[model samples]
Target: MTYTRVCPLAEIPQDGALAVEIDDTPVALVRSGEGVFALSDICSHAEVSLSEGEVYDGTIECWLHGSCFDLASGKPTNPPATQPVATYKVKVEDGDVYVSLGSDE
Candidate 1:
């Protein structure tokens, strides 16, 4: 997989999410606790931007329908979203964040 440098790890707020695009794919860079995760920015149920939602306990909630998704697996933890979104591989090096969209991790 080809890893692309998205931004510095500091850019993503703690316990929050950041919206970014890689190769025309909208992705959400989520920072929860002390870890970083990457997933599709769009919500499966409402087709809204997941990055604008709430992040807590390793899950991101869809702002429109209140569907919470696991940051690592992109699986919807609650109803309104039965399908799982896509998740990508992420790595941190020298305080910078890198993401790979070649395949869902």
Candidate 2:
């Protein structure tokens, strides 16, 4: 899979998220204590931007309905989201963040 550079690693705040678009795919770049993760920016339950929400403990909370999704697997850890969002592969190289849209990891 081809990985496209999204943004600088410094752009994403620690324990927070940032929204980016690669080839028209909206991706939420999340930084947790473990590492950086990439997921679909839209929340599965509300079709809202997940990057606008809060990130804690490797989970991103949906701002609209309080749904929390796990960054690693894109699984919803809390309601009102039942379905999981899409997750992409993420890599950091030379202080830059890259995301692969070819597969839903």
Candidate 3:
């Protein structure tokens, strides 16, 4: 798997999220607790930006329809969103965040 540096660790607030484009792919970088997660920025139910939503308890709620998605699995934990978004591997090194879009496996 190839990891690409997306942004600095400080760019995303604690328990918050950020939208970044890597290799022409829109990804949502979420910070929950002390871990960082990467998922598709587009909401599976509404095609809205997930980064604009609120993050709580390792889940990100879609601001448009209130659909909440799990940051770790990219699966919708709430209604209005039955499909799961794509999740990528994330790593933090030297205060920088990196993401790998190899496989969900």
Query: TM-score of model 1 relative to the true fold?
Result: 0.96
Number of clashes in every candidate structure? 0, 0, 0
Tens-place lDDT per residue, model 2, 19-43, is: 9999998999999996999999999
Summing lDDT over every window of 10 consecutive residues in candidate 2, give the lowest-scoring window: 96-105
- Tell me the spans in candidate 2 whose CA falls farther than 4 Å from its real position: none
Question: lDDT value for candidate 1?
Answer: 0.95
What clash pairs does model 1 have? none
CA lDDT of 39 in candidate 1? 98
Model 3 C-alpha lDDT per residue in residues 14-95, reported as the tens digit of each score: 9999999999999999999988999999999999999999999889999999999999999999899999999999999999
Q: What is the lDDT of residue 67 in candidate 2?
A: 98
TM-score of 3: 0.96
TM-score of each: 0.96, 0.96, 0.96
Give candidate 1 regions above 4 Å deviation: none
